[model samples]
Target: MCHDWGESGDGAVVVLEGEVGWLSCSLFSHPSVYNYTSALSTGLNLFWYRLPAGHDLEQPIGYSQRLSKERERLWLQPATAEDTGQYICMLSNKSSCTKISMRLEVLARDQVVRGCEPAVAVAPSQVIAPLQEGMTLDCPDLQDVVKMADSSPSVTWYHRCQKFPTWGSDREQRGLSLQIHVMLTTYDGSYYCTVHYQRRGRELQYSRSINVTAVYPSSLPKHPSILQPTQDHIFKVEQGCTQVRLECRGHFPYLAGDWDIWWTVDGKKVEELNNSRFFQNNRQVKYDYGDRTVESVLLIQNLQAKDLNREYNCSVRNQRGFDTHRAHLEQEVPLPSVELGCGLGVTLLLMLVLFVVYHVFWLELLLLYRSWFGTDERHTDDKEFDVYISYARNSEEEQFVLTTLRRVLENELGYSVCIFDRDSLPGGTITDETLTFVARSRRLLVVVSPGYASQGSQALLELKAGIDGMARGGHLRVILVQYRPVRRQGWVRELRRARVALALVRWQGDKSRELTSRFWKRLRVELPVRRVSGVEGGGGGGEEGGSEGEVALRRLHSQNSTSSQTGLITNTVKEPQKVISIAAYL
Candidate 1:
């Protein structure tokens, strides 16, 4: 009845009376990447017991054991016949405990159970197991009798070797057919199916060991191989050409699996087959260097003076690993061969003669607007204008207005006028002298348009500068050409402070009218009467007393005829034309 318990090459086994217990070399303890630990709900509990010598019924003594709850391990000293019958190791957190028991039946060699498959291999089909699901694997046939818990096909699942849970139908419950509702990591390896059945009134048990190698992707490539030199290399042929080859390898579990490889040159991927430069045992870089011949071979061929001292890299890869190697060649080239001649010089001269850009800068070639341009150097006696044209982005439109005004002033009235535009500046510098022009001018004509207002931050900044100039008592003129009529509410609030309003020209309506020309004629008539000059009105080019809002509304009214007017009445309400004026609703 007394028996010894131990581990051997084939796994746990039982020895009957008068039998020599054989231990396989595999059980001697070797390095194993497959080693894992199991967890129980509570501390580990080890139960050791044996039958008395000469009596199968007497309780055996002298069995002592110790277990570590923190380490989850149990150790027994001097295992003997009276020391082992059934040794049960159980883990429990006090709340719950899972138990696994091994029986040691000592007997003669002739009493051995024949044809029991002690070896089993379980391969998981997936990386993660969802709760309440069963995974399938090829079950090893053992002892001509395979029983999951000595019954039909349902076996309770275990973490290490402790029962987790068991449930299944008769059809869905055999061999590897037990299901446990447990959300588990891929590393949760302890699992097995046990067939439980009765035989001859004695309790019989058959269990298959479940070794779950939780399938998951590796954290890193097995072999991180990289090419040394870049594929695109600037090389001096006098030294040597760069020669590159693909070097590939991987590590860990990937070595036990299949993989592929590939390569990229410069920025483009080089297919393995098309290039004659690559030579191998029919193994192209396209195969990912998996084969023996292509694993570490250089793809660049014919290292010559032309390719000398160049850089190139060879890349190798697979599903779980990658590697690269860069190379350099040392073939020297004669520098004396490179030269230039008189024929080439003559061709260059002819091209220079034909191409204008070769002789002139782009600015000198721009369209000349002679009358609308000015110099940074202004004469001390330069006559000041009643208005300064201040525009941010609409240089073209400003130039057109400048041309018209210049003709109106000089040709028609024989007055000297100066205008500044981007084209007017010889070197495109908006210098202090430009600001001086703005300061000297009696009035500033700011052409407001949506496009000009939104050109950039600089355009807005320029508008701000113009406003600052106006605040210093210099006249500020605003010419709001109805450019698509997009309402700018914020700008209107700011413009309310200045004694100025837009010249409202009637848009294309059913009513026939010439509002722009009439406004110009009105401006001509008002110019002599309202001109502000001298110190009290000095630099304040606009008339000292007029409501800007009234002017704006009056201009708006002038554009409409009584017949086409909306059903709204207009009345004149006397109020200060302050910059921040809120007009009365009329």
Candidate 2:
């Protein structure tokens, strides 16, 4: 037989080789070569043949036929030296002939008795595919083993040391190939393919191991969602130097490099805000279920009013899907600084005005205060006399106060007057009489003359009594009548102190009508109004004395008579001589 070979008419070729332990061959028929032939239109009439070493060249040797269903492949069991020969495949038609051939050289039985190493080369040593994709593991070069042995080997596949089932059509182990319709994580592990054959009537087995690593990409359980700050997703902050935080989260199956979380403001990335007042924080949490969560936070510090109503977006993404949430920042209303300043200014101004009024117009203020809050009318009614007269102890000063002021104020002004000298009982203590009269009178009229201060303790006693009475509830008021322009040097310590608070009057004297003078007006203001009775006598005066010398003599007589009538005299005097004498001087 010819060992050299050539390409067939269709440019198809067959290469077959057999070593001491393996046999393999590949026969390829060019479909275009039979395109026009009717007899072999289907190109299905291919056949396999062998010519033994001693057989006739024209005869075909056929025993234990082994060929692929398409007649495109042929294998044989392990062969001895007797089975070494040429193997051929023929494509025939009525008009043409195509032949593919290979020669097998088998070793002696002793050489074939050697141990079976892994004769099959399974590609690849490792198989990796994503889940849900199809994959195929092939035991290549098995045909070479078949060519040496002259028998096709049976291929079986095992997964994780368990024999893989071929019950489902989707899973198959054909010849030296195992096919899986779809890959799954459950199918990940070691896979072994065992090739069982007979060589020289001896059963032999060989196997190739491979690892199938199925990659299962993580998937999102649900869409991403925002997990915090439930209120309308609006955060309220003060205008100045404020901080706000927002969080976005989502759930996904735990898959490395499969999920991403980030924050954005107004469609701008958070990192882009590094130069601005915004900051970012990120976190991820895993759960017991093959699920996990990713959280993204945005922090805004020193927030401004312009930031109000600005939208912030938090986004979470994965292979399954992506989610985004929106939140708005709002500013709270603040009190205006101008209004606060105005309120403080008004309060201070009012306080200053009150202080000025208290210092400058104190007397007037006191009078006004008394009118509103002083003792009622009942207090005034308790006073027995409207005026208490304190005069100098000297006879001339006494005579002037008794004749002029007492006569004018009591008779003309309809006032009840208490004249200490006249009202005091003989042999009574003067101090007791002074205090008693001062207490009973509503107004104390002091005759402030140069001689009054020279009277020693008598003047002191009278002034002290009046001051004491005024101090007790202020029911009694004091009037200082400057009868004669007394010098400041002559002023007693008590009088100087009391003068600031007392009512002072400068007598214009008989030079003008005393009733119409400012002195009388001011004096009457300090004294309460006098009450009138129906039985009161009309104003009276005696007929002018016969002469100045005669009036002087009668005044002495009238003074003696006034002193003799001490206990509450209703009328001054009924005798013409006394009334006429006293009225003449007035």
Candidate 3:
């Protein structure tokens, strides 16, 4: 006799023949139902009955007649040949009703001996083993049972009597092994393997079970971490220093041989306790929380200038990953000295002040020096004419030379002016007259113009005489007055030679009063000091003073009324020509 079980509408059923079995009539409740009275009210009620062979209706049976004293189990006595019939179990509640029936055919003992026995036997084995969390668990091999079958069998795996769905289909027979790839503590239980086979037009099933226990390791280490030098991680070292010390630390779980720590300068690696300029010392520490920390001290000895601005890397590595911290060793910058800065500021200020003064009052300063040291009684007695004027042969230029310049020098400025056309004796040798006048004059004023450059002969004669007088070391000074713009291309050799020796004053038109004042002042500075002679003004004096000279000049001017009136004189020895009247004043 075979027994089977199935679930009905709010209950479960169990059918058996000629054997003892328990029937649970309580309906399975959903986990969400919290009230006990509500669950009990909806539970299944049990009923039992019997059906005679070939009968369609069931005969009601009482629990006291066929059930054991427990009333939850039904017991059938031995010698079941008289009990060949159908047994039915019914279960009902307010929400559902269900029943199950099983037929029993009781044959004689000799007839049961003639039937075939079961061809499959489930193996019995027990396993008590400890597995890690990540390890795999395999079921017992079924190759022997599979070999006995004609074809490959179907296999199902269960954990704790429930279906195991981690592996893709539980029914697998090709390999005859079930695997739990990654085991956990929840997987620690009895695992069942059921094999199904077909033999002689009959289906056969067998089962095997094993127990597993999962165990965890004592400690698991994470990746190492560096935890020292919290603020910016920058190291300052002076150039040419003796040594620099740096510290690096890391934290990790207390697992031996799982972490490595070191240091690197730039990109090259440095080791601990090495025989080099850069070396380190390492130590390991443990905490109560099972964490191991490692620290390394780097010693860079005999630091040089080249070590400045270099990066030092501290790296830690373990099974998980690595970490690096960088520190820079730089030279310290020094502040500037106050004394040096003050000295530089003073020097610049003085230079600027001197430049302004020189730009504003240079002429006044020169005049002051000349007034202090320029006059000498010994040289004043030897000088004759105060100034000699030279110009081109053109009548207009001659008139200007005789009238404008001569009037300013002799009349207004009290200087005796000499010109070749006026001061020289008519019919005299020109070269001799030129040299004589240039020698007698204290200053040779050459009035230069485009017309003057064309009169090569007269300009050269005057320039050469003046240059020779200057070379002779007399009180002869040459001054160039640029009356008009003149090109140097037509300049005579003598004029070119005197260019560097002579001082030039350009004549802007008299429209600007400031310019005219500046012009007169510059020209007067070049002239010699005025000397008073007893013969010229009835004053007898070997030493000249400023007051005496002014009086003598005023008296001499009163005597030369004709020359002062006309500012010119006609050459009396030959054809009439305009000339500067210098002899009357001299």
Candidate 4:
């Protein structure tokens, strides 16, 4: 008979009788209880193959059931944890066959979340470590861990909302334990754990909070600390002498907020101390308030011999913490005076001559230059900019310049472009006007030809102007391109030391894959794209931190070649683009 056996989980089995030719059983998920089969007698050794769901079993060609009197079931030699789910038993005789059902429940331990008890606790109540130094977190013992389903679960550790670089994810056959190590500041925040369950229907989770404290040596003075102009209490009385201001530096581990500063004179708090002011690390006192300042300075004003003997302490107080520092005045040393009519007069004469020459020549020339040309109009517009291409003439390298520009602007990002041409200069010296442009730009992209850096006067001047502009917070974008290789050395140091150059691109031209990958990495740092306004018919632009746009831009730039005019890079490498044509805008 064509038959099979029901799984043993729902209570089904096979029986054997003496002189019987064969007996077979059939089993499967039942529609009703009518399909249930009775338990089997002790005769045939039932070999049950337990498997996970979707387990692949190498099917036997024919069914066979052998009888064993010593053992009730056939011995599955050296059974593994994998052999622990559900199985079917096939029974057979000479003529026909008999079948039985069996179910295997693998006892696998998932995880043990330390319940009720805090996972970790510091002993000294407060834990402190120097900033950037190493620290540790103690984890509790995992002694009661047991096999829950049929396999063991894993223990994962995390800190500061970031995963620790070093971790353990390996599985052990016999035991389970873990030691979590962390470096301070590198790991400063809440910590938790999650277990990857081997069992089909169970989950493991645990969590705990940790407080990290950073300490520094000999922090700024706190409120209540004494402050004075001189370390020792002594000074000479003098007319028009600037007052000595007192200050207190606050303690380290500064809290994150504004703090109040105050001074204590002769055991009494001094109110309206005009010279004292609050600063980040320390309280400051100015001596010359009337000297010239829109805001009150921290310097003390007026000098008196009696004031030197007095004691003054400065202190700063914040809600989270406070600190004070003490100081005493010392003997005042008078400014040394040389023979006024001789040495001082000679110095005065020289300064007068130099000042007159500077005003007559340098100052006048600067004013003339400023009035003639004025500032470039580009700086008047308001846009946070990243780069500006500043390159000299190279008829041979024009193609390279244009290609690089398009790659950086259209294909790569959302930066504004201002291309300067010598032919477009308005009736003035082109060299002066170009220098003005380089100075106004945020970053200068210098397109260097094979001998561009070595080229005559004007090229060096443009490059120098670009360098000077960058010294005032502007960035430098260098694109050195040439058909013939240029050996970079000596005076051409920056160009030689360029992090990302088109020349390097040509070197790895043979390995296009690696070269392209490196080129994109360099572009990401140099040319970051801006958030684009969502179009009425477009799908994106609602994401935070430009992640949506970044992903889109990455997909666009991964093009293999410049083909169609649509200018869209085929991002077959990225996820299939969801081109949603929205009729409505948000």
Best by lDDT: 2
Q: Give the lDDT ranking, best first.
A: 2, 3, 4, 1
Worst 10 residues of 2 by lDDT: 11-20
- Model 2, span 1-586: residue lDDT tens: 2222342333222221232233222335344443324424565365566776676663554545332322254544333455566666666645555665666554433432323322333234766655676778875456655664547778878765457683355667654688778766677766766667776676765556677766544332444444554434776666564687776665655444567778777788877765567887777765533356666677877766677756677777766677666777776678798999999899999999999987876655654555455553334477767788887766677767767777666545556677765665654545555678888888888989887744344566768778877787887788898888888878888888899988788777675345655666556556654322211333222211123454344345446635644432323232234334323322
Q: Quick one: ranking by TM-score, best first?
A: 3, 2, 1, 4
Per-candidate TM-score against the hidden true structure: 0.26, 0.29, 0.35, 0.23
Q: Which candidate comes out best when scored by TM-score?
A: 3
Off by over 4 Å in 3: 1-343, 375-381, 393-395, 402-404, 410-414, 420-431, 453-460, 472-475, 511-517, 529-586
Candidate 3 C-alpha lDDT tens digits along 255-350? 435678888887777744354888779898655333667888989888767676666888889777788888877666655659779989999999
Better of 1 and 2 by TM-score: 2
Model 2: per-residue Cα lDDT at residue 241: 45
Q: Positional deviation of 373 in candidate 4, in angstroms?
A: 39
Worst ten-residue run, lDDT, model 4? 577-586
Candidate 2 positional error at 307, Å: 45
Q: Tell me how candidate 2 scores on lDDT.
A: 0.60
For candidate 1, give the lDDT: 0.38
